[model samples]
Target chain A: MTYINELDTPCVIIDLNKLNNNIKDMQRFASKNKVTLRPMIKTHKMPQIANMQIKNGAKGITCAKISEAEVMAKAGIKDIFIAYEIVTEDKIKRLLNLSKKVKLSVAVDSKYGVDMLNKYFKKANNNIDVLIEINTGLNRCGLNNLDEIYSLAEHIMNSSNVYIKGIFTHAGNVYGAKDKNEVNDIGKYEGNFIVKIKEYLETKGIKVDTVSTGSTPTAKISGKIKGVNEIRPGNYVFYDAIQHSLGVIDIGSCSLSVLSTVISKPTEKRAVIDAGSKSLGLDKGAHGISKVKGYGIIKKFSDITIERLSEEHGILSLKNSKIKIGDKVEIVPNHACTVVNLFDYAYLTDGEKILDIFRIEARGMVK
Target chain B: MTYINELDTPCVIIDLNKLNNNIKDMQRFASKNKVTLRPMIKTHKMPQIANMQIKNGAKGITCAKISEAEVMAKAGIKDIFIAYEIVTEDKIKRLLNLSKKVKLSVAVDSKYGVDMLNKYFKKANNNIDVLIEINTGLNRCGLNNLDEIYSLAEHIMNSSNVYIKGIFTHAGNVYGAKDKNEVNDIGKYEGNFIVKIKEYLETKGIKVDTVSTGSTPTAKISGKIKGVNEIRPGNYVFYDAIQHSLGVIDIGSCSLSVLSTVISKPTEKRAVIDAGSKSLGLDKGAHGISKVKGYGIIKKFSDITIERLSEEHGILSLKNSKIKIGDKVEIVPNHACTVVNLFDYAYLTDGEKILDIFRIEARGMVK
Candidate 1:
């Protein structure tokens, strides 16, 4: 390992002790609520971190793409759920091959996705679990009608290689909530909506075993709704400015930060840092949460505001001018997942000492 | 070589013919005005592309960081100018080593930067070219006062191992121009402003040889303002939605696009594609150009608006979308530079034939 000062500028640093605490705290919450925790690996994308979560009690892992699942499977992760549609023939063939090596389940929202999966699984002479994704309120993707859910379940049951595992929904709209009460309302609606769809399928003689729904904003409150058997929250692993503004986590709980050095003090009002959009990922805080203001929150100098960014330069507007050239500072970005994907490796630290390095092995696996 | 149909989804495709035409056009413009062209490699970050630029009659190449200069130097490029400040001892050592291999010049706007470089070069028994960066109007990293410029130049001249090369400025504020006339005005100001600085330095018997200034929007008009010897214009190589909105390049000249597949049509108005913020980046378009509206402009479907993006999903709000599941489409991101840094490799193609694949070699070298 190396000291933090010796590391390169514009690098990602993860607090290891805070990381373990976040993982254990989430696992404890899931266990107390009698619900399974399937953390999404899209946040960290490190195999070591995923195994740490599993060792502490995550039931499985949630991935957004087949390529990410392949990375996890190659790292010996046996249980994986791809919470996205797989419609292409090449992606289906790859998924079928991955199913032979792991307990694979996929979320399907359309007939075309299921038809392709069923076609490939039949040729492989194997069966895979399918979860019907329903739209709770986020109009992005998912089946919005109960009749369509029932029809898709029946189609899955009729197929020789596909079986109904359960129903899942992502309460992504909670990210736009104005306060905690609105988040609670969205959580209740998300949990009840999934249960309603699952109960409707059960009335049609289909046994639905799981009802999974959650986002970081609704994870804690949605578990009390009595139907969400599994909660998949990704951002809680390393909370950020958006989570801080949403009141999902305190600012002190944020474990990921970008370490940057003030390279130029151009004027009394401006200081230029080495970290820019390439390191911080041009996210402008949360949508409907309390306005946190600025691209990120500077850890040391609270009066400094990150006014703007070019490709490799972050312009900070100084108030009272407490910063100087060559001074190092840490910035908590608005989103941790995107920032994690920007770096090739992150320094694992324990507040004072460096523990090890975490390689972002699954980065750029967007396909 | 591979066919476009044989490539992976959510991949970048560069039109080879369009790329060469863009390179030649910029070269021809610079040659006609008798200004040296130093295209910034931050747009593509590929050694192959830099070599191509140099081979097409570019005088040198420009980089945004010392690590980028190191990359180009290792690729055998002889003339390189890092258009940003280098402050830390570690970075200065790297810069000095790079100077040993190539004719390297760096921009400095602070005493701390020049002091560190001077100290390092003194110990190494070598001298390096130093350019004082002046703020034309970007309000970013640059000295605003002529007195500070004179003092910094005096300080560099007094140093035992540092030599003053010239003065430079980036007309980054031109991106916010509302019309071509404003762009032309910014170009003229950027050129004349540096010439004035050079003239003042000459009065002090400094004999500044170079006065470099240009941006993609101002490059076409800046050279005619007299006394601006070199123009460093990036982003014109692969124009994006922002450039198209600024009237810098036509939409037909944009060479880079993300090839994506419509995976799900959840509703009549909404379609989901595989490319998202992770592939196309989260840029909202240019600074103050005309609002081209949307995250990106789809090549074939002009009526479709890319409403939003998640980590791995692009949500399209369609107006009578003829798009179905599994249909391939190309998207030109709002900003091309960030999108280029997102992918590890990009497909090179002519209109109907696959030409080659170029890797983004210097990506993530933010240090």
Candidate 2:
């Protein structure tokens, strides 16, 4: 059997035991809360992991792009959700094609998006389900005002080829939570707010089937809320330094890391690893919400901060650590999703023994 | 003819005319300064572009990793300089195999790297050329002390299979320059510093054949310095917002742009594009040296700031702009190299007409 330590430097290694445990824990948590888990595949982008999640009890998978959803659908996933707004004709066409392969639903926050979806699906002589995105917070997308939500729901229901299946909100703002208390507060609001919108839509004779809310940091709390039927937490499968910093999980729970070799020890207190932005990624957090202080946390040598990164070099600030050239180190990146996107494949390891290699099949599916 | 405007959203587009002009201009500048151009292929990672550079008078190509060099070599590239230290046994074996295919040179900053190289090449009964990396100011890698440099040079000279060929420095510190004057200062120092190191080695009875220094912002000034015989500038082929912010090149000189679509207008003052960190990259600059204000520059609407990104969505802060859903917009990313690494292929466009598509053949070659 191959060992993870024997793998080439600057490669991604996923702890298979930790990965399965994470999947089981999240699935169990969702089941206990009576909320269907529709884990976002964008975190790993590996069909194998998605299939594993499915086998562990995920009802459906969520994707950030139609291209990603297409990968999942091709890999035998029966239910998929594109959790981002679909606009351009090329994407809408792809979305319709993907819809034919699986039970597909898309997110829509704009009247423009609803119109485009309606136009494309009507021309294709097909119908598509859509989740009206609500802006409980995060302010990135979705409608915040009750009037806008009502009007968008009406617009989607009025469309001949479009059906309003649910309402969802990503409380990504919890990533910026000042403390665990703030995370809990945001989680409660995220669930209550989306369910409130679903109730509001029902009051107007509009049927809202799903009340979905999610974010790795707030998923458990939000999923446990009354009336929230679905949770979509992507990063929980591979808790990163950002999640760890936010009190979401501990270092041992991190399933993924970049296996890098110490390539240089330029000074007594400084060393450099082969993994950089090209391998580990440059995600402090979305909009600088994370409290992560450096590029990553050097596994086992947690005191050694990854001070900076170039394209292919990570500069580490060390204490009295004896890191030297040729020494291998594993780095738990600040953000796992972005880090996973930078690799073509990752080795699955049970502790030190590498079991298999899985392709990040949906990587670079930005279109 | 296919038009760039008609292509899929969140796709990379290279202006063929601008790309050609950039290649020619940089080649002319290097030739005029009497320095051999060894453009780093890490920026484009396309064999076609590397071949074009060679055809336009580049002496060789530079790669950050052996895998990238392997890709270039497989595409019939004859000479490659891997400007990073290679450690592990796996990488060294790959390096030796690559040496058989091309005239390969690697960088060495420590005795550890030199000793590893010597051990591998000796075992394989082969010799490899190495350039001593000098830390001019970036402090990321390379030797800054003269005594250490002397010892490393001596160690390599003592090895049976290792030979010292040159000394090089990447004046990446210029990325943090406050203005053009500072960039010029760093450039002059970068060239002179490596030349001084080469002279020092020579005075100690060591023969150094080449003296190299480069950084897109500092290349022009540094290349002009006497005794600096080689320069390697990667991003000069497709200058980005970081280069523009550093006054290295104008926006028109930037050949690469992400063709994205406005997917959402969540508020009157906010619009979201399909391109996000996945397409544009999150490189503000290495070590936070870049003065770039945002993730990228939205062409035609300079006033619009890409405030933030969420894997598949770019949130734009708009002020009275008429951008709407389904409208196509091109964005010039903050860093071209990282941005190019995000795509599988990029469309070559001669203004509006699409000429060809080039695969990013060496993408995700972090290993």
Candidate 3:
């Protein structure tokens, strides 16, 4: 019963059918675009899911931290791209060690990033690929400046241990898109920028192997770029309410959901569910209303904004809704990626039948 | 080094001095007001911390979920209050059978919520106490009307094996307070509502053994109520940056801090930390300047706002200062309560010395 019935509530339930379709769709897109699809494992955090993606023809997996990359390597995922800037004494040692097990490629955006990385790994390591993360639009965590790309790539190639492999950028700006047209525009803009930089780096005689760009919205509507060699999209694996709102994917395409029981019906409009800030995070109102509703749109309920959520309770008050007490509702979170980080394991189902229970192996390793 | 590092940037470290001081303060407040102190176990979720509160004169432990209560029960906590409405067949079994280990009390709001709880426990071998949760102002999950509570309580009291154990309400309203004056105003309003309800219930010949009202900010200023018999405040144990911003306590008095490494300095203005929503949750904009900054404010790196975070990266951008690589920064998270839920284990520290390591046993149990 624990496997089927005895497992806790508010745990993730992954629809295997939707998940499989998602993997194949991404593969199809990569094949159509003639780009190596390196699906980031940071989205699902399950090694088995990584295997599923690889089995469906992903070139490699992209990880955010060394711990995640180590897990992928242990699970026999040799071709790995750590899509993050790695620094610090202990982390670099771990990264260098990971390179021994797997084909590791790390991202760098500054000269200081390369200096610390080179100092740690150059002694034992012969060649490891490094990608310069360019800030196409998201000012959060990438290098901005067309002038800096050639020098940045040169610095990495000049390092005795590291090879200047490519350039990557997350079109996080795509999430800010008003519609699908804007998303496509962002994709085109990003694609052109990466190609422009790739050509610029090649003219400067730096080996820019992988020109990549992805964010859920950009990844979904992305057509093709001549020079871009790879794509590193993460969230398309299990599109959430946020994705659907942005017209990236449909609600039926969302694989992950929270199974919550209705706790209280205080009023006609306002019902309460067991899920709260703990299960469904405070990442609401990020994109839009239809895409990411209050708390979560009750899958059993209709168009209901889970208007308020405290630590332990979620208050649901809405128009155009028919829901009842004791009814177990599936909630597609505003942001599926952040919610997945809250649990150690999740139940994967093919909707009709439960597939298997998998532990989120590298869910929280912040060292 | 992760276990016993001088740097505090990887995990939540509770200050013993502030914890002990806060405990005495809560106990003294409860004692002077002639109210029972059942410090909510949900905040710390550590048996040792709960035991310390009990040793310093708390009546019992208050937990949000039954699973959390079970963990505390194993640590020898006797009287337990689960301050959440329980539903579903699986949860009903938990409520009916939990008395095998310790005394269990539950808070309920709706007629359906009480009926289901009573149906499972009314004929049970062990007696269970039910507390009617009133909607003072939080409007999340509580009985809205006073009259409905009497109906719900009478039905429970008249049931075969269940007992009515008075009432409870979270002055969660205080979270909206603009200042200490507003907090005090809300506290008095909370006291007035609970006192009136207590008197009304007593006049109706109901056994109101426990009349509880709480929340850190409200409880800090709430002196005495005529009929309220107990106070249950969970977040006070590890007062967070939100509490500090509310003027209830100082930042120095905050008992919890996340020890993290500055893993990536990809750009000049922005650096990234290993800890993100997985360790320090993206529970940003909870209170004030402390609230709206980001998920956490760097205790050491004040000029940096952990502005945006992905699943595994906390984007620390220098607002007006510089953050170099390999720097270990301590962050005061927006809310300490949810951060406690993020880790599998936590290290209890007395400044530079590690006292004990605790497993957050009921972590990830959404049921």
| Candidate that scores best on DockQ | 2
What DockQ do the predictions score, one after another?
A: 0.69, 0.81, 0.56
In order, the Cα lDDT scores of the candidates are: 0.87, 0.90, 0.77
lDDT per residue as tens, model 3, B150-263: 787777767776678888888887887778898888888887887778778888889788878878777744547676678888888888877877788878878788888776
Clashing residue pairs for model 3: A1-A6, B8-B259, B9-B259, B9-B260, B10-B259, B10-B260
Per-prediction interface RMSD? 1.9, 1.2, 3.3
All candidates: TM-score: 0.98, 0.99, 0.94
Residues B1-367 of candidate 2 have per-residue lDDT tens digits of 3998889888999999999999999999988888999998999999999999999999999999999999999999999999999867888999999999899999999888888888999999999999999999999899978988999999988999999999999998888899999988999999888888888888999999989889888888889988899999999999999999988888999999999988889888998889888888888875566578878999999889998887888889999899888899999999989988999999999889999999999999987
Best by lDDT: 2
**Interface root mean square deviation for model 3, in Å?**
3.3
- List all candidate RMSDs to the true structure: 1.5, 1.1, 2.6
Deviation from native of the Cα of residue B309 in model 3, angstroms: 2.9
**Candidates sorted by DockQ, descending order?**
2, 1, 3
Question: Which wins on DockQ, candidate 2 or candidate 3?
Answer: 2
Clashes of each: 0, 0, 6
> What is the docking quality class of candidate 2?
high
Task: Give the winner by TM-score: 1 or 2.
Answer: 2
Off-target runs (Cα >4 Å) in candidate 1 are: A286-290, B286-290
**Which candidate, 2 or 3, has the higher TM-score?**
2
Show model 2 residue runs off by greater than 4 Å: none
